[model samples]
Target: MITRLAGPAMHRPKLILVLVGIAFLICGAIGSMATGRLTNGGFVAADSESARVAEILERDYGMSGMQLVFTVESDGGAQAPASAARGREIAERLRGDERIDKIVSPWTDPAMGSMLTSGDGKIGLIIATVLGGENDAPAHAAELADELTGARDGVTVHAGGQAMVWSETGTQTQKDLALAEAIALPLTFLLLMWFLRSAVAAAIPFITGVAAIAGTSAVLYLLTFAVDLSVFALNITTAIGLALAIDYSLLIIGRYREEIANGRDKRRALELAMQRGGRAVAFSGLTVGIALVGMSFFPMDFLRSLAYAGLAVVLMSIVLTLTLVPALLTLLGDRINRKPLREAKPVEQSLLYRIARVVQRRPAVCALPVLLLLVLLGSPIVGVKLGLPDERVLPTSLESRQVGDLLRDRFSGNGLGTVQIIVAAPARDGAVPDLRDYQAALSEVADVRSVTGPAGIFSGGELRAPAGPGTTAADSAYVAVATGLDPYSEAGQRQLDALHAVPEPGATVLFGGFAQQTADSAANIAQGFPYAVVWIAVVTFLLLFLLTGSVVLPLKALVLNVLSLSATFGALVWIFQDGHLGGLGTAATGYTIATIPVLLFCVAFGLSMDYEVFLLARFTEEWEQSDKTRQANDDAVALGIARSGRIVTAAALLMAVIFLGISASGVTMNRMLGLGLALAVLMDATLVRMILVPAFMRLLGTANWWAPARSRGFLEKVALRE
Candidate 1:
């Protein structure tokens, strides 16, 4: 297949380049509009209780919760005549806006005055419900935030809430994406030039990188019409696309250069390089792509969007690597090696070969310390706490975060953390008693400050105010329960659990709020996690077995990949969750983002398998060529590590460069992703790939190539080899 593709490229390199260039240009044009089409919210599971409640609230009750919060600060005091007047003016301004569905302020409704005012009486809260769906709400909130946030008429206002936070997060992500690209691209090129030792050869990877990103973006843009995708998917697509492009390019070019130096003509060299290196690239992409597909087992669109983005990027990288890269090498010919930065060393004399030899001699002695180190590094994962993203995910410099901090610290109650409960009770007079009892019971639960419902505002199992208009409908009623806990914290999750445990006889209850959403999302992920793991494992094992015709090799690769990934997760927990690394400019949030671990597992697993495929391919090739003896197996292991060592190391370093640049992002999630993947790549390349693999292979001997007869026969018929 590779030969057939390279045949035309070798004969007509210009035609291939022209056609690929035109396609990339078209893709770039279509992809330029993708960001606007992407959404900022997908963290909730669609089939979860919170989602059902949200849908009911929107469809049956016309309630979307508080989409925006305004913290109004007055110099005099909250009840001062001037301050009160300003607060009323702000309320009236919001009431007049067509986009606002409802408004609640201390100045407008004195019945709930104390709950909306700060403890010191110097700050007041105004909550507004925006009239729109999830995508439209953020946009509306951004406009409102811009219009109302700032000092005006002797009072200062700061805007925040779900919609505002979503808006700010999207804006910040765009800026961070630009910053990441600025940091990663130039550094990657310099490293590429150093590794490839030719400006022309380095350019090939860059070209392929740009094409992959653009093509993936275009695919995502089209996908948005069919299903909602997260804006954050763009970040992963860019980082992984560029990294894979460079990785595959290095593998192909390295082999082509080795073939050329061995006296093969340019055309024959390209053919052999594509045949050998291209097969590995294809298998590597399939492994990574399958791993990413495991995310679809989860119910959250956030993970699914990432899955789609990753799959698209992998597909683009593979297609271009097989086609455009070979064509470019065909055109460059001998010029690909011009102006060498350094001369190449023989495979047997390379540092990787020497290290493998030492480990092979004393497999147990060399393997134990590395395993212990990885285990020690991975120990911190035991304390990992997962939660959904919130204001803290944004930098403290943002206005929304500042407002959120004020609400959490200065305010008397958690208005933004209000747990909205929908009760499916008939809105007749007969149901009023049951609804009031349910509200009072909720107010008496642990962490509950108050509960306002159709019957009245209840606290400590008693009514504090009369029934309010708009809290009841024909067949449903809305209850807002306020608590002081941070909604995204572990304590807040406990509060949600307590709320769920409360009995509401004769009426069905659905909880909807930021806290409930977080709890549901975590539950959904936990429920699906085992299945996703099984899928990844089963498919990865199958792909590896097909590539190597060995069940033992696949199992070894899976176990080693897990160890490396565990260490990576532990580092992330220590640095991002426990807040040990203060130098990265991001503070520890005490909890990992719920989706981040799942995201990292799929991405890093696929990437780890990527390098695994690279090394194992060479091992299989060498073993196939040798006599069937224990000494020959050891020699094959050494020669395989020696032959593919530089390509793997260079690719890992380049991939690390991309991820490290991602670590420079101001957003904590992006930082965690960047730093975690960077750690995973470096550890896998040096410790796992260099030390553990060679040691284990030595210990396993001829058993490493063992497979059942029937399985071997099946693989022989469908193996992805030249």
Candidate 2:
């Protein structure tokens, strides 16, 4: 297949270049508009109890939970005439806004004034419900946050809550993406020039990287019209696209240069390069693409959006690597080797060849220590705790983070920690009695400070006040239960579980709050995790089996990759959750973001398999060309490592540099992703590929190439050949 495609590319290189240039221009224009179409929130599970309660609150009760929180502070204290007047002014401004569905403030509702004000009486709270769903609420909150946050009439007001946090997070992520590109691209170019040893050769990979990013963006732009995509997908696609494009381009160009140096003419050399390098790239891309498809097993749009973006970028990189890169190499010919930076090392004398020889001599001695070290590095993963992101994920310099700190430290029970309960009870004779009992039961749950409903305030299983203004309707009841625990803490999760366990009076009841939402999101991801893992493992095993024509080799590759990924997860827990790496400029949030591990596994696993396929292709090719003896297997392992090690090392270093640039982000989740990927790639290249693979293959001997007789026929039919 590559042979047929290489003919036209060699025959009309100029035409191919012109057509690719035109396509890039079109894609660049379309891709520039993609960010505007993306959304800021996909963290909540759409079918969870929290989401159902939110929907019912909006549709049946004509109200939604508090979407915005403002901390109003004055030096003169809460009851001072001037402070009271300023608080009323802020509430009045919000009350007139069309975007606000409901407002609760000490100034507006004196019935709950004591609960709304701080214990010291110098700070007060104002909470409002925005008039939209997840996507629209953040936009509305941003506008209100901009206009209302600042000093007014001598009272300082700061805006926060989930909606405002999402808004600020989206804006900050865009800035960080730009910063990451600025840092990664130029550094990558210099490294490429050093590795390729020529300006013209380096430019080819750089150009392909740009094309991959732009083309994926154009595809994502089109996808947004059909499905809702998260803004977070943009950062991931950009980094992965650039890294894979350059990696594939390096493989093809390196092989093309080797062929030319062996005295082959331009046309024949291009054919062999396309046959060998091009085939490996095809398998590598397919492996990575299949691994990313595992994300589709998850129900959240966030993971699915990432899957779409990842698949698009992988396809774009493969197409450009197979077509445009080969055409450019065809045009350059002998000139591709001009302006040498350094001399190339012979494969027999390479460092990887020497290591492979040492390992082959004492395979068990070499393998056991490395295995122990990896297991030790991975020990921290057993303690990993998962939760949804909140204001703590952002930098402390941000307004939302500051407000969250203040609320947690200085305030009492308020909207920030309130648990909203919606009960579906029709207007019936004995409804009030059942509701009273239910509220009393809820109030008795551990961590409950108070519960407010039509039965008024309930504490310690007793009523303390009359019914509030908007707690009841003819057919439904809205209850607010306040607690003092941090919503993302383990205790808070237990609190959520306990609340759900309490018996309800109504036939249907839904819980909606920050704690409940976080719990539900984590639960949803956990439920989907097993299915995703099965899909990734089964499909990856089949693909590797087809590639190698050996059942044992594929299984060995899967085991090594999983071990490498476990170490990566442990590092994430150590750095981000346990707060050991202060230099990364992110505070330890005490729990990993629920999506980070899953996202990292899918992406990094595919990438690990990418390098695995590259090395295995060379190994299989060398083994098939020699005798099938044990000594021949040893020679094949050494030769394959020596031959493919340079490409793998160069690609891993380049990819690591890009990911480390992304690690500089202020958001903890982005930082975790960036640093974890960097660790995974570097570790896979050096430890797994260089050390463990040679040791394992030497230990296994010729069994590495063994397969069943019946499966051999099927493997022959579908096997990838270089």
Candidate 3:
């Protein structure tokens, strides 16, 4: 099928090339509109307990996760007439905007008390709610923040909150994507030229890359009308599309050059290269697409958008590889080799061949140490903890991050880190629960600095008031538990766990707050993790088996991929989570965001399998051409590595450079993702695919091709490799 398709594409290369250019121009225009439509928030699962509570608050109380806070700092106390008057003036001005639902300031509401005032009396908070909650926050946040950021009547103002943070994060992400590409494209081009040894050949991947990115962006734009797509998806789309484009182009162009050098006619070389390379591209794309599809099983829009973006990008790359790349290759013909830095090495005599021979001679010695090293590196994951994305995900230079730091450090006993306990009245009694007893239980819990409830404010087992204005009860009573520990820390989670265990019988209890939200997000991810693993494992094994016609190789591929991914995860924990990379001048977020590891596992695993498919496709082809003997198996292993290793290594190096450039992002999570992904690609290419794959193949010998006799017909029927 691929050979037939290539014949016409090669014959009418100019027409096909013209069509491709036209498609790019059209899709590029549509794709440019995707960014404005993409959202900045998707980190929360809509069905989780935290989301449920948030929804209730929004629907019933007209409250939302989105806020726009003005921190007005002045020399005089915030309660002084001058400071109070200034704050009210700003609030009153904002109140006239119909898009603003409510504005609260300590100047007008004495009940807010210290919750809105700094201990030193220099800082005061003016909190306002958006009309449409988080759904509409981003649109309003930028304009409101601009209106509120400047000084007013001698009071220095800083604007922040969830809305402000979201807007800034979106802006920073776009900047980072541009900066990453600026750093990556030139370096990638140079590396491609060095590998291909021809400038004309090196530029092909960039064309395919641009086409894939533009096509995928247009698809994402279409998806926006059906589902919310995250702004971060653009980064995923660009990086993965570029990497896959380079990878597929390298495979096809290198194979075409080899066939031409072997004295085949240009037409024959095009046919053979597309037949084999197209199959490999197809199977590799299926593996990646299936892995991305697994992320869609999780309810979080963050992961789901990646699923959509990644799948679209992979498919776009495959189409370009099969269509545009071959069309270009056919047009170039011998001119593709117009420039060469040096004489090309023979396949059996290259550096990769020499390395494979070394590994083949001592399979166990070569494989065991790498396996052990990976296991040792993965040990830190046993202690790994996850937290949801917060203001801390932003660069410290951002005003929102500064405000978050101020709140955490300056307000030790304030409500910023408080856990909200909502206790609904008994359905039979229609009366609020014993608020005093509930408050007592909460106060007695370890790490609970204080508890404010409808009955009173309780601390150290003492009630300071019978009825505190801060605690209001309608159909449900509210209890606020304040703790000194960081809400995302181990101690804080423990305190939250302890709060859940406190006695509050005959009442429907719901826990909500920053800490609880983080915990719930982590739990939601964990809940979907088993299904994601099963989907990837089952899908990849079936796809690899169909491609290779071997159960053993698919299993081996999974193990090698796991080993490589484990090493990447371990590095992530060490450098990003444990803060070890700070000395190396890399950014570190003290905890990994909950979605990152899952994101890494799915993406990195698929990428690992991509190289696995590339290498194994050659291994199976060589084996099928040889006699069914142990010596033939050995020869196949060595020959396959000799043929595919350079391309795999070159692709890995180029991709690693792209990932590292993206790691320069100001957001720590993006940096973590970039660094982890780069590490995974390089390690898989060098340690796993190059070293361990050959060793294990040598050890398995003829058994490497073993499959159930009954499954042979099914495998041959669906076989993706020529």
Candidate 4:
């Protein structure tokens, strides 16, 4: 199979490469077109608690629950020349702009009045939220910034709210993803070359990984039209794609080379590589892909994107494993083992022998240190802070970020996107009262800073703030309210629930905002994520167990896998979120990505397992012929490490470096995730795989073969048994 394809490709390599290139371009063009229409929008009523409560009672309830906040503040206490007057002018101009469908602020123009409030009571803020699918933000922002900034005016006028946040954050997120996308394969290539020590061999794995990314990226691009593609999706796809591609290509390439060295004909070698190595690659990718898809249960759009991205990358990896890799191997023929492939290095008296000697000698001495280290590192997780990602992620020089800092200390800043408590008209049994009790109750909440409509009617009913003629105490009859709190903090979440707890007979209560959203986001993750981990483990176990015919070996693989992931998680805490050693490269402002843990766990698991499969599969094979299971195991582990460990470690190190490269980015979320995942892979390659795996395996003894009797018997019957 490989010889036929390679013969024809080698005859005309340029033609085949060009055809592939053309297809890639066409796919990209189509994907780009599709993504163009798909804009990343802010999750509104989503971030608010009041909106959620209201969503239950009516149609379009979710749409009505979000509050739009727009504000412009003065630079410190310095009085600027005529800026306040310009801000007032901008407001007047917006009152008549056709692009603006609505304005909610304290402006007294009865015609344009919707609650437009003046900042400093001098610098006025305009609030606009899309209720009927209207976005007055772009036009409003353009006019305001142009009028304010264009005049060389020191006073800066900015428009922000759900829409603005979405527009800005989404664009930045794409750039970060693009950086990752561009770098994943090149990094994969360098590692493969350095490890394999053969340009052809190195090129093979990287080519496969790149194809997987490209093909899967096309597929994920298509899925975007149907679902919201989370910015986090690209990270997952690239991570999984690179790992699986490397694994898939590695297996086939190794098998092809092995067949050749065993004196098989070119065609015969290709056939064996396809028949045997291909099977393992298929199952491995499938298991990992299925695990990734499990994230969809979380209900967050971000997690959902990972589901499809994982699935796509897995499929792409498989395609390359099954097709492209065979073509490459057929083309390379005997050249793959450029180092003059040595006969299987004797593993009998190697590291495995030493470990076996440890297990056979003094198990307690070997295992104690290993177990103690895992527990010690896992301890800091007790202090884990699951804070939502913040806009402090933006460079301090950015207007929104600088102002957000001001807001956090002096006012609410971006953290103000919390606590939506609904105040509404009083209701009688089975009937809403003519009076707006919701508006009145809103004023009663101690956490509130401002209030907006229960003024308009939903399918549920109208809400109203407390009654008053002017800006003083008597203001009434609004939807629910707006409040200030540390968004997503313990106090903030409690305040949100308190607003929801208002049990008034006269009016309906609702809570919605950053706190409510964050709480829901956290809950959804907790319930949905265990499945992802389980699915990965179960599938990986089945595949590895079958390939090796050693239930014990899979357990060993799993242990190493877990350790790799845990070590990285701890490092992530120390570097990205804790601000300890944050000045070092795995560094960023002390904020983690909102969905990073999920991505980090999945990506790290896939990567660690990538090395696990490459090294252990060989051992499982050798152990088949050696009746002495311990000797075969020792030799395989030792030889596998000696032969491929350098390459895998190098690849991991390079990948980690690529991740650290992103630390230089202005976006804090990107830096956090980049640094977190980088440190994880680096630690995995050096400590977890090197020190811990061998030490523990040295201690497990034959009971590491703790399979149930029936399964053990089955494994023994199959040649896969070690």
Candidate 5:
């Protein structure tokens, strides 16, 4: 198959390369525009109960929640007439803005005025409801912030809220994407040059990386028309695209160099290299692509968008590896080796080879300790706490984060955030038992600060005031439950759980707000996780079995990959969640983002499989060549590591470097992702691939090639071998 394609390509390499360049230029330009089309916010499923309640509240009650906040600190005191004047001025100014739906401040509603004032009586808030969707909030907020903040007649004003958070998140993500590329690209080019030892050869991978990224970006742009693409997908496009392109190119070009040095003519060498290297790249791309497809099983657009971006990257890398890289190799010919430096002396008993031999000699001795160590590393996840993404996910220095901190620490009522409990009842019920029981039950729950419903304001199981004037739905009413804890914290989750467990008579209760949204997000992920796992497991097993023609090897590979990820998870929990590495410029959030584990699993598992296929392909080749003996098994293990270990190590290091650059992002989730996946790839390549693989294979011996005799025909039909 490869020979047929390459034979024609060699005849017109220049034309093919030129067209490839043109396509890249066009696709890249289109893809660059994708950033503008991308929207943020997929932390919770839109169809969830929390989402439904929020929708009802907004559409029916005209309460779209606090989209932006203006903070005023009085040079005097918050209760002073002068301070009230400034707060009122800011509120009136916001009301005058056509974009704002409503502006609520201590100066506007005397009943809730004190609640909006700080404890020290120096700060007051004006919470504004902006017109637009979450994606539009940032632009509106930016404009409002510029006008509302700085100096407002003798008072200082600062603006913040979810709208500002999303807008700033989008902005920071774009900057960080550029920063990661800036850090990774030059280093990657140097690494490629050092490894290939030819500037012309090194340029091949860069070209491939750029084309893959641009093509992926262009695909993402097209996807924006069909589905809501997350701005986060841009980061995925650059990181995964560049890393995989370079990896596939390294494998292909390395093989081409070896075949040429072995005295094959250019065309024959190219055909042979394509047949072997191209096949491996195809399988690797399939494995990575399958993992991404598994992530798409989740209902959240966040994970789904990643799948879209990831699949584009994988497909682009495969196409370029098969077509563009091969064309470049044909065009360059021995120029790939122009002014070639002398090769390093071959070490028959290198460290990797020696380690493999040692493992093969005493399989249990090597495998058990490593397995134990990985499990130990992953142990901290036992204490994992999941939460919704909040302002804390932003950099600590961000204005939004600072405002959130002040609100949490200094204010009351909505400052702590509210959980809206929707109580549905027919108007014929006349707001009797349904509203009364829900309010009373919720008020009786532990940590319940207050509950305001159609019946009244209930606190500590007693009525504080009669129900305030507001439009009552013909069929439903919303009771706002206030808590003293941040709604994305453990205390808030516990409070929310208690609220849900409360018995409501004659009403259908639906909870909404930050706490409820966090719960709903967790529930959705839990429900979707099994489907993703099943998809990944079944597809990976089938793919690996087809490649190796051995059920035992594929299952073994799966187990080892899982083990490697355990260590990665362990490190993430210990360092990021537990703050063990807080001294290293790490921003430790006591709880992990709920979606991060899922993202890490998809990315890390795919990368693990990449290295797995790379190593096992070489092992299968060696096994096929050797005579079927115990001694031959030993030789295959030794020789496979010798031939492939360098590529695996170098690729792992380079990919890790790229991911480390991603870790440098200001976004906490991206930082966690970068660190976790980098750790997993390094562990998989060194500890699992090098050590555990040889140990397990040695222990299994000839059994590594075993499959049921009934499967022989199927294996012969599908098995990939040299």
Candidate 6:
């Protein structure tokens, strides 16, 4: 059934495409090195208890600043005070560092007006108030941490607070990102090797994926000039880029192999693949781009930059895979298939195939059963929790975690954390708030412990603190508060609401706390939801129209894609939020993070549509050749189902394996992604791809490809442009 063009139209010019890709690669390399550390516009890592404490001090506490908390430990098991004296020496050293605005260790806390040390004296702390901006933070903090490592033989530095959290998270995040690429690329190579049965073809996609990530990183580095970037951006950028590289290259190579098997010569097979598979790939890339770009609705600068970063890689992935992979195929040709694996091929029909056939036969029976199952998984969304991030990251069995538990139990949620209500411009001469009035109002509220203000600033209709030589009106006031709610508790969320509600007459009020972080994240999602819908719609139509050359076809796919994605998201809400999955315990990332709905959709839509494209591309090809609607439809189901179905199932299983591996890493973010991705992959591979898709197509009949001739011609032109 492979048709060869009789004239010059069959062959493509390969040398030019190769040169273009090389040029892009060279340019991309120079860029990554320059921009690797920029935060890329993520909301500064301020949604934490430390941030909340900072906010409370600036707005409510009548102070100019605050201090951090660190836990410096030693597993060296020293019995004498001399060994413990070494830990004290490290604290003393840190107390004298120049970058340290001030320090509060056992020797210094009395002046800072704080606790000197823990009761046993084994664990000592140094509280430092940094003087410079976030830019100067990592290097300074790292230097400080490195300096402190000397006093004890086996010191385990567990640092938290804004400074240490950002620095350490950045380092660990790089490791995670590397781990993802390290795992994905090798696995892709193994899968490709098994599929193409040749080391060359297998290596080509892996190489292309690496190139795309490398190149995208370069471009992203430059993007940091115009925007902020996250410390975690580098790892995520590489991971996403690598994933997409394999995806697009796999499509092209698969088509090239299919063309060759259908009796076309190597050169002709490359052309057909570059044309057909390239067309599908370009559309798929757009779909992924839309998913990535759609995050712009979120107000968090981190998300905005993250969206751009992901889109950049998807575009680069498409470009490199379509051009470089094809050019490489031109050179490698038949050698790409040189070493086919020698294994017993499974029978054509499988349990998945049988289920698909049943759906094809009865349609509704196939759709209803799986649809219900997804609904059940998503029942956890009702009691969703959201909030500031903290590094209570260790297990309950760990000493630090255990001590924290004891403190919470003894003090009824005693915390270094604080929540603030910032009444903006309150210290201006005419507009200065009455400290007596403000304090009285706040005191009336449940948690108000103390209120401090600027020089001459008043609350409770009077000045709460004596006017001092050290104070200024421009400086914000600080308030201290007692709390019945745990800093991490759902009940604490109400504190955020009250803070935001504080009277700001002729001024502004900001709630800065862990509760506030969660509140803002939730609020951002609530407000941005409509935009997300519009974004998804625009993205879905554009990708679908490009793929099938029919307005109707893309719309139909959109309907199902939405259905499938929502089903998956809904399930996550249920299992994680409702705690319906009893064994998972309190460990889930509380209702999948405020941003996860969008993240999940971006990932799930592209993946779900993956099988759709594979199936529809084959089906459409058969229909066009035969012009007998029923015959072509049957051939597509039989052949398309026969060919792509196996690959889809295989890819899903592999993807599941990778996700499951990360799930074992014990990071909350990774675990959520693992569950969501694993669910999406499995469902798309079987229920959506095997059952719902075929059922819908069977119901659509000839109308599935109903584009006016002019439109089809337009699509053909579009394909050429692609």
TM-score of each: 0.96, 0.96, 0.94, 0.80, 0.96, 0.80
lDDT of 5: 0.82
Q: Is candidate 5 or 6 superior in lDDT?
A: 5
Show how many residue pairs clash in every candidate, following the order shown. 0, 0, 0, 54, 1, 44
lDDT of each: 0.86, 0.85, 0.82, 0.57, 0.82, 0.59
**Runs in model 3 lying further than 4 Å from the true structure:** 1-8, 75-82, 152-154, 339-344, 425-434, 446-475, 482-485, 583-589
Give residue 590's error in model 3 in angstroms.
3.6
Deviation in angstroms for 707 in model 2?
A: 0.5
Lowest-sum lDDT 10-residue window in model 5: 338-347
Q: Model 6: residues >4 Å from true position, as ranges?
A: 1-41, 44-67, 72-98, 102-126, 149-158, 338-355, 393-415, 425-429, 454-472, 475-486, 499-508, 549-552, 570-592, 626-639, 650-666, 702-722
Worst 10 residues of 4 by lDDT: 469-478
Model 6 C-alpha lDDT per residue in residues 83-184, reported as the tens digit of each score: 456645766676666666655554444432223334344455556665444556545766666655443455554444455545555555555655766666
Q: Tell me, by lDDT, which candidate is best.
A: 1
Q: What is the lDDT of residue 223 in candidate 4?
A: 78
- Write model 4 residue lDDT over 1-722, tens digit each, in one string: 33444444445555666666776677666655443333343222243443354454233332342233445555531123454455556566666755454554434343322223332333445554433231334334434444544322555566555444544555566676677666655665676776677888888877766666566667767877777665545544655566666766776776676676667887887777776666556655655665566666555666666677677778767765676666676567777676655465543444544544444355466556766776676665666656565556565555555445545554432334534444343334343344344444544666665444433322122333233332111221224345566665666666666666755535554455567666666666676678777777787788787776667778777877676567667766666667776444332434455466776677667656666665566555555556656655555555556544544556566567556655445566566667766766676666666666655555554444456767866765663321
Worst 10 residues of 2 by lDDT: 425-434
Per-residue lDDT tens digits for candidate 3, residues 1-722, read 56665666787889989998999999989988888888877777887776776676666565564777778888887877778888888888888987787787888777675678887878888888776554577668778778767776677888777778888888899899989989998998899889887788888887887677788778889889888888888787788888898888899987887778777888898888888878888888889889888888787888998898789889888878888888898778777786442356677788888888899999999989999999998987887888877777788888888877777666554445668777778778788767787788789888787788777888777896666553444677767787776787777888888889987656888888878888887887888899999999998998888888899999999988888888889878887778784713433446678998888999988888888998889888988888879999888888888888778889899989988988888887788888889999999989987789889988988999999999888876777667
For residue 249, give model 1's deviation from the true position in Å.
Answer: 0.7
Q: Itemize residue pairs with steric clashes in candidate 3.
A: none
